[model samples]
Target: GAPPPPPARAGGWAGAGSPLLSPGEVRSKPMTVLQWEKLSMGKLAHTLWGDGGSDGGAKGAAGALEKLMEPGRAFEIDISALEGRFARPDPSARFRRAESDNSDRSTVGSADGGTPRARISLLEPKRSTSVGIVENKLRGALGGKPLRDAILEVDEALLTQDTLKMALSAVPTTAEQALLLAFQGEPSTLDRPEQLLRSLCGIPRLEGRILAMMFKAQLEPDMDELLQQVDSLKAACEAVQGSAELQALMQIVLHIGNALNAGTARGNAAGFRPSALLKLAEHKAADKKTTLLHYTVEVVQTNAPKVRRVTALLPTLAQASRVSLEELRAKSADLARGMDQVERELTALEEAAEKEEERREALHREAMEAWSAAKEQRDEARRRHREGRAAARASEGGGGGGGGGG
Candidate 1:
């Protein structure tokens, strides 16, 4: 017997049926000693010896066999078990609920905290300055009072251009304004930016005041530019109108043009339009290379050199050419509209301030009248008490005298 085939192991081989040959196949094949040794030297040897080839003795064989014969475990992963262990509910569920509640509240135009929501803000907290800083600056600018009162007291002269620009940037968009208006959340619960915006929203005519201030800040530069353009145009017109040299140059061109057309129907020309000066370049001389303008220049240089100084007007003409009449008109119209808007806003602000003053005065008067009435009533009660006391004393004296006489 070839070592009496090793007793059947609990797991058969390597935790399953033999990897090399099945039990039935081994019985049918009846492998020779050489074939078994060769097979054992490979996978079977490693499996039996636990990766260290057998130590070639009964003791080592017995130990490896004992190790292999032990009960084997198959690792099976149950996906459902994994899911139960690791799955988690959505973390944002509460946030979603709060948002829905806020939406409902907004629609109803009421503030009710059915669910706790994340704080909302117009600007990022980490990237922007704290809302407190912004609020403080605004408070300082608006006279450190309630927004409603501060807006009325805002002084255009006190606001710098940079401040106006910042205010313009912070001006809420229509949708943002609507959102702010709809917000019914507790002010303490809101982020600083939101709270500031909400306070601004409570003021009357806030947008108009900001826009008017911005326009006023820009008005000086706009007026200066407009005046500069006008001055440039005026200088150009004056140069053309008053320059004797330019006038003489034109006269020379006119005389030369008439002499060239002599004997033709175009001869004896007394005058030509100012536009005809441009045609001087179009009329070529007999050589074709020399233009009428070239000829006129040569004649002026040779005969009347003093009139050539008209070239000084070239720069003025160039500057005037760059000035677009239509653009100037458009700018002027825009400035006018801006000024009117500013005036209206200022007038409205003044009237609101006056009305606020009148209301304060009226309240003071009413308070004074009430105080006077209360004082008069108290004085009358004191006078009646004194009179009653005096009459009582007189009756007492009269009674005592009568009793004595009796």
Candidate 2:
């Protein structure tokens, strides 16, 4: 029979006579034996002397030259069998063999008929402190604010494609290869691009579930502390609102202000607004050595030293001022949503694992741990929300009573 369809171009190139095709275009077309022979001869001549060109051009020349040099001689290769000779043994197959043979040195023969991929030892990963200081700083900063919002502010930059690629590169080769194989097939559930990425990166199919657990680990403490800070701020605001000594000092300030403006049109006011407090520092004496607030502080300290306790109560308002209640609640709600999603995914995994014939005990155990941690975080967040609400209600009631008295 006539030479079998010219062997599909190897190294993905077409004849030099044709346009230099891109990688995507190269696979779609094939060259005839005569064309391949001419290209091949040119490639051999170039290689022997110098290609003096790009690598792809040189390879194309080589592939064509290969056909010319072997004219009339049949050449064939069994690609399926190539794996045994060139590729590493499937990790799962090695694991199964290791189990059955009860031997750790499960071997696979190489192209040279030598058992090269045998008794491969697993190595421990090296420890690095690249992000230790940053992690600590993040945890510390989260002491006073919502963590999710803070993380969201920079998560886009931190979790970029480059970062994921670096993370994938760090995974062990066997684990990485196994993960890639598991996701290599078309995904029945995930988007094509996302599945492709997960396949390439060695990320588990249920990584969203795993990632939620990871996030909870990092954020739960911050959630707890933020709730406490919110409560403290509410308590402080309530303290400021309910302090009779503070109210008395305010009355003195109003009286002094009205007396100073006695002859002016703005004199003898029924009450001074709270905003007048901010203007106290702006009012300077003739010598400019003291502010009106300093004088007021002296007067209060001299006549009612007990009222000085108001300064200690100011921290609650100060802390509260730094946080937006609306944004904080939104972050809390987001955490609750994330936990709910994790719970749902865990439920789905459990259901799927139940019907499987294989022993998925390890997968089940991992799912359970993630589920437990997520549930605990959800419970803690719910409890803190309750406490924050009660504190807020108390603060509101105290302010309402104080306002009613005024």
Candidate 3:
């Protein structure tokens, strides 16, 4: 039988060819690649050799591209899997190499394989800070307000592109991919609120949720993954058998894990009611194991430092498992304080409004009373005039009759 359909794609030129076509039949070997050699070296140097001066690690990759593109040579480009390094994991953070000439590009991509991604917050928080400071200074120099607006406009514009759809479509980094994609924009590149949101987003899906949060915020993916990751952590915890911190961590981890099963059947979908994500699991370690409520406090307490520490320190803390009673009380108090202040403000506004309404009613009553009194006076004067005229007419008739003497 004849050879099958040609391969679908090749190195940057997608949809231009088909599969099942051999190198010989396709005539796509290194020989036909010579034309690229004739292109301008300035552009070529940037493309092939890569930037030698900076990011010494990527320099090798660039050089490899240059060698493959050499004229009069036959070759084909393919990659089994691509590896990517992330600078910043925070959504607001950008992937950059100032020294690298190619810093202009949003993400480092391989034509065939996807690029790697990470949250800036997860690694190198210091670098994240320096980038932010530089951007702030630049904006200050350039009249600030317009720069931010302009950047937002650019990002929004890019997000609407059909071609960008291609980049976003590949289930490329299906696992926790949001944080990795955070470092894609530059200072002047953002073009709208959405872009800025996407830029400011941390840990991808989670950060995106916060930036795009509506009144009813929900985290679908993480809620789903919570169970599996917890199970792994729980087993690790039990196996450790020592360290109070470790045990506490395991307790919370198991709590979260149990929540996954307690809800709807998982696997078909990893989703939970916010009620479950918000609360701890039912399982309890009697006496000192702490109730689920206390477990929750332990969780928040443990994670607070972890989020900050994650910026510069190690992934030293995972799942934020320990919450002190005092910390829990403090957090609860703070939450209540916020609600109280809002209530007080609302009450004061309502009282002032009510008073204003009462004053308006009083003024209306006074005006109506005055108007009624004036109308009564006008009516009474008209009645008296009519009566006097009637009396005068009666007297004139009687006098005329007497004078006639009839």
Candidate 4:
């Protein structure tokens, strides 16, 4: 409850310290309405009830408040003058209630004791100071009604921090997970924002952090899967790279290609890209039954039977050959970039949790796991990459020496 207003002045409200102004008179006021809003509640109370003490000493304000609420005394202010000269409009339209009875009315008396109406504005309601405008932008991407209901359930206490954490945790960590969640609802209920989020599509700046966290959570599994594919491809490429069996097998195919293109510019070419291996089966003989590659296979079986099993080395060659070596290297580089970003995000999350011991500890554990997994996968990839490079170097040297000889 508010401390009561000060008592009416004894000399019929004539002095500068008077609560209400006499008619046809004006006096300088201390604060504009906007400035009044900026004042603390304690300072505002002092502004309204304190004596003419410039130093803001506690004695004058306390004494004035004590005197104001003394029994049977009425303190008043000129509302019309305040409204016309001093009041500034508040955008938030918040105000404090002054009367104990929950009524908006206050009594003003004339010489004949007739009542007159007056209006007084008070303080604004407290706002959530911790929330920033940037974080609020996420609401648009979070699905409006559901997010609003969630916020209502959580209330405004520590709302900004708590909502951020909830968003990070609730978002799907992978495209597959997100898809499952999205379809869990009825087909008719599908919406654009939900669809986008479920598909791991990027959101706007306000909601971007949550999406980033989701991507970070997915990095470990994604890296593992990528490394597995890379290992398979690298193993296949290495097996085909330096094998004398593969060289003999290719020598048969090269002779066929050259004979078919004899006396043409294509026949003069020394070598072709390894990716052209797939085209071998497409070129049929004049009989339209046996392919050039089939004849090469027959030649390998007839002349170099021990090297016939060279074809067995590349079990995944069809799938692996669809991607170039450059593409493989690029994918590995992209994983490295993603790991770097995740590390930076983990560091930031840790710093933000400085005041929260439990969260900080949990983040520390997660960071350790993420770093260790990334390091192990990276080291394995480096070892495979070295093997792939050595095989490629050996293949190039062997192929160059026997150029056109077949």
Candidate 5:
């Protein structure tokens, strides 16, 4: 036959005698016997002569040729396969594997493929710490389910602030995540800890779930504490307002202030600002020793001794003073926001779980339908075979009777 046309190139098939026809390209395209021989010779020359330049290239070419031409080797060369055999390994892939190995080895019991105790040990190096204790408690609270499943199925009561915190801390690191993802395609290769880690990583928005749980755990206690603080502050304000001793003391201070300003424009003032109490010590007596505060104390001791009981309110007032109303408001707002966030995360988790359940059901339904269809097809085939056999037997019997009659 006439020489077959060359295979189409990327742009289009090269024209006859095109100088751009590479050795590999020429080999890949259709060619006559003479053309194949000529190209094969060219390939041999190129492999032997080292791209027609460089001593290093010559040495590499010779090394490659020697390997290819060794005893028992086929004379024919597959350039594509040979290139593949010599291709450099991906650096990033190598790095990831190294990192994964390091992470596995770093865990306490990963080498032995991990036991329950070993898995627990992997949570923290120092098991005596509070965090470790919480992690242990969390593990128990999870009821032996994988962390991912526990996030979905665990009772709300089982999730405490410390346990949630521990769970958050125990979330897999990047290297572990990578390892787990790699093992997803080959789950049987995973060790116990790896299996658990893989499952934990598999949960949708796992970090968000743990965070929501943490926020939920803190919500009640924080709200209760905030309410208690507000109540205490209200009670303190009420006590200050209702205290006869405090009222009496304020009255005395007012009278003393009016008397001191007797002849001035401020004389007989209706009442002094409460902030004036801070300056009582600045007002000295004639001897430059006794302050107005001291004189007020003496007067209270002699005339209104019952008013001395106001001293008891000092500690409560001091504490109330330290409690910034603005800060409390901010805290309350933050708690509210946190609660909202928790609700959103929980809603998302529920939806995700529902969707997963639906997907599973759909797959199961599909499998059943497929199985039913197959079974029906099998039954039909059997029925047809039986009917065919019966028809053949009847036909043979009729023919035999006819032959007998004849």
Candidate 6:
């Protein structure tokens, strides 16, 4: 059976004999205390051994289910499977044995198979399950490129040539196109980085291309050229996805830009003021496109007054002639609700004007009464003085003649 265990090497008395005399037949080796529990059968097979197995093979399967049953004993895992490193492959009992045997042979191969040259070929990095394998292969493709060159290559290949032209020119050959339509078809792709890939790849609708460019400009810095391209692209987007919803968003953006930009040289914010544009900010487009339209409508509803105020201020800011619309509208919406409170206060002041007039009349009446009392006292005092002079003259019988004789 299996060549009688290779005829018991040298002095070792082996003949596929089952070790006995132990309490329980001892079966193969005792279970390893490795984190066999963490790795899946496939991981055990791939990372631990080589051969083939989606799920780990027999040993891994036995070990996975048995690790918990095992109480104590150190079991070594694949170096890759060590804490913080490897991803566990899927598990399968059938493949575990084949992979384990492969690992054993690898050890044997290195130890005694042949020359160092043979071992090197056997242990080529590409042939192993190491991430370095692919990393090196990619480097090999670049022919020893520097990091900066690599980035430049990506900008050209991934951005300009690959997407702005190739991918943008036609539908995708992969399922990506279907997925794109499904996502862009609905609104599921906005937040996902992968979904944004369609725009980056230039696989979306015509208008989506401009939005994508805007988003790219937003994400990338100092790319003034690309940002400029966003303007022309905006026109294309408008023409392609020309629905009411998208139009409304467009109107809102222009007004907001104008309000904020008021007098800036950019002149970006003067185009759309709220009053001149709300009716223009249509969300009732006949074509059902889930885009900036739905997003704008939701934003306006959530912060209705802010949207209205931004639209209304558009015209006034435009009058500034050379201000940044961004500057004018910069803080216009921070207190959207406060504008309401200001109107309320003005109304209260108007109503209080009548009550205030009544209080003034009452104060004037009190002052007039005090003045009349003072005048009456002065007149009475004068009358008493005159009478006193007359009485004195009668008693003395010579009031005016006495003074002349003296």
Off by over 4 Å in 3: 1-317, 321-334, 395-406
- Candidate 2 scores a C-alpha RMSD against the true structure in Å of 45.8
In the range 76-162, model 4's lDDT, one tens digit per residue, is: 223232222333334476466466674766787757553332221111111111122222545544545344344324333333453
Residue 154's lDDT within candidate 6 is 38
Error of 5 at 7 (Å): 99
lDDT of each: 0.55, 0.46, 0.35, 0.45, 0.55, 0.34
CA shift of 181, model 4, Å: 28
Against the correct fold, how does model 5 do in TM-score?
Answer: 0.50
Q: What is the TM-score of each candidate against the true structure?
A: 0.46, 0.34, 0.23, 0.35, 0.50, 0.19
Runs with alpha carbons beyond 4 Å of true place in candidate 1: 1-158, 173-178, 188-193, 244-307, 318-322, 380-406
- Please identify which of the two predictions, 3 or 6, would achieve the higher lDDT against the true structure: 3
For residues 56-123, could you state the per-residue lDDT of candidate 6 as single tens digits?
34332122222322233221112111111211232542253345765566332435542332222112
Per-model clash counts, in order, read: 0, 2, 36, 1, 0, 45
Evaluated at residue 219, the lDDT of candidate 4 is: 61
Question: What is the TM-score of candidate 3?
Answer: 0.23
Model 1 clash pairs? none
Top candidate on TM-score is 5
Per-residue lDDT of 237-322 in model 1, one digit per residue for the tens?
A: 77775555665465455445433432334433433446667776775443446566776776556445666777899999998888
**Candidate 6 TM-score over all chains jointly:** 0.19
Cα-based lDDT at residue 319, candidate 3: 40
lDDT by residue for model 2 over 37-62, one digit each (tens)?
11222333333112321232433322
Superposed Cα deviation of residue 288, candidate 6 (Å): 30
